[model samples]
Structures are given as C-alpha cells and as structure tokens.
Target chain A: MPYIKVQITRENVTSEQKLQIIQGATDLMVNILNKDPEATFVVIEEVDTDNWGVAGEQVTTLRKRQAEAKKLAEANKPK
Target chain B: MPYIKVQITRENVTSEQKLQIIQGATDLMVNILNKDPEATFVVIEEVDTDNWGVAGEQVTTLRKRQAEAKKLAEANKPK
Candidate 1:
C-alpha cells in the first residue's frame, strides 16, 4: 500500500479537484510502482497562510512582498 | 515552518481528535525541531480502509484474517 499526501496553502477546494488528485495519485502508483488502486491512499489538505511559512516569514507576508517586487520590476522595465 | 500531514485508514473522525493531532504535531516541531507554532501546519486526513493495505492484502481483509486466526488459536489452547 502507498499513501500519498499533498498540502497546499489554499482553502475552499472543490470536491472535483480532490477526486482528481485522488485518481492521479492512484494512477501514478499503478503505472510507476505497480501498486494497485485498491491499496492506494491519497489525501489532500489545505493549510492556512499564517500557518505556512518559509525563511522565518509567514507565507501571507512573503506573498505580498513578492507581488510588490514583481510590480516594481515591471514598472521599471523598458517597453 | 514545518508541515506535518497524517493519513489514517479511518472515517468519521471527530473534530476533537483532529485538533489533538494538530496540537501534538505543532508541539513536536516547536520542542524538537525549533519551529514556531505560528508557522507550523498540521493536517490530519482520514482515508478509507478499502484504500489501505499491507503485505499485498487489503487492510480490511488482513485485519479480518488476523482476528480469525487469533480466535482459532484461543479455541485450541489447553483447557
């Protein structure tokens, strides 16, 4: 049996997407690892931005900074 | 920040149980890994038993077999 789990920093995911993930995970195991779907498990979870971070900064704050930097670079670009 | 995901072959898990898992994971990170709770993410997923297995047999079937074998051994014990 293979257990696969994916964690994304988003909320309100639709059931259809969850099903897609589950099927894709099962298919990967069967195709690559020769595992059977009846014994495969896929779990997708959504984590809040505040609870997800990198380099000692919350994801929410890091995302905002990234967006600002991108906008600034675009404004200074020659067109 | 650290993300911890748990996948268990069970369904209809109570909210309290999930909370305990989340808290336990966060505590582990903070205490052992030196990760901050504010940046820790814990997601507990409940998977169906039909999708879990061990030793090339479905977990459900394996458990049933184990239970039956245990009963048989008990019945054959010296009396």
Candidate 2:
C-alpha cells in the first residue's frame, strides 16, 4: 500500500481542499508509480503556526515578521 | 535532515504524549541514523476515525463492529 502524508500550516483550509489533495495524491501514485487506488492512502495534517518552525523560529513569529516587512516595502514603493 | 511523521487515531492524546513521541523519534534518528537533533523534525498527526480506513472500511465503522463483537463474546461467557 502506498501511504502519503501532507503537512501544512493550519490556515483555515476547507474540506473541499482536503478532498482535492487526497484525490490528487492518489492520482499521482496511480499514474506514475502504477499504484492501486484502492490500496493507496492519503492523510492531511494541519499543524498550528505556533507548533511549526522554520529557520529556528516559530512560524507564528515568522509570519508576523514577514507581514511587517511586506508592509514596509509597500509603503516605500515609488509613486 | 531527517523528518519523521507519526500518525495515530485522535483519541484525546495529550500534549505530553506528543512531546514524548517527538523526542523518541528524534532519538531514534540520532542513535541509529546518526542524524543531528537540530536537523531532525518530528511531526505527529492525529486523524479522526472517520477519515482513516482499513480493509476498505472506515475505522469508525470498524471500531463499532469490533466493539459489538467483543460485547457479544463477553455475554456468552460461562457463568
């Protein structure tokens, strides 16, 4: 059986999006790996920003910093 | 970098248990694979029974059937 796990930040992802991800992953295995759809499993995991980290920093903090940088850049854009 | 993911049915797992899993998984990589703990990532995913399947049936339905069978067997036990 082919099992796939997809992890993403918990950002209000809809059930419809999850369904699409499951279908897409299953399709990829079936098409490329010639895996049986009936035996394939796809699981989606949503982790909170506070729990996820990048570059030794929590994603929650990283997002806030990134947003502030983007705002500063926009304010400095040429007229 | 080594990334480990553990998936289990969501059954009121506590934060402490999750922390243990993360630590245990990281230790495994460190001891056996000789991976750096700083570069190792462990993610624990808790899935709903309805979302997980086994033997072509949802885990929710399978658990119900299994519980009923266990109850029936207990009822038939000798006095």
Clashes of each: 0, 0
User: Which 10 residues in a row give candidate 2 chain B its minimum summed lDDT?
Assistant: B14-23
After TM-score superposition, the amount by which residue B29's alpha carbon in candidate 1 deviates from its true location, in angstroms, is 23
Residues A1-79, candidate 2: write the lDDT tens digits. 8999898989899999999999999999999999999999999878966555443344566689999999999999999
Which RMSD does model 2 reach against the true structure? 8.7
Per-residue lDDT of candidate 1, residues A14-57 (tens digit): 65566666677778898999987777766555789999988999
Which ranges of candidate 2 are over 4 A from the true structure?
B4-79
Candidate 1 CAPRI level: incorrect
Model 1, span B1-79: residue lDDT tens: 8988787878578889889889998999999989889999888766555444443334555578889999999999999
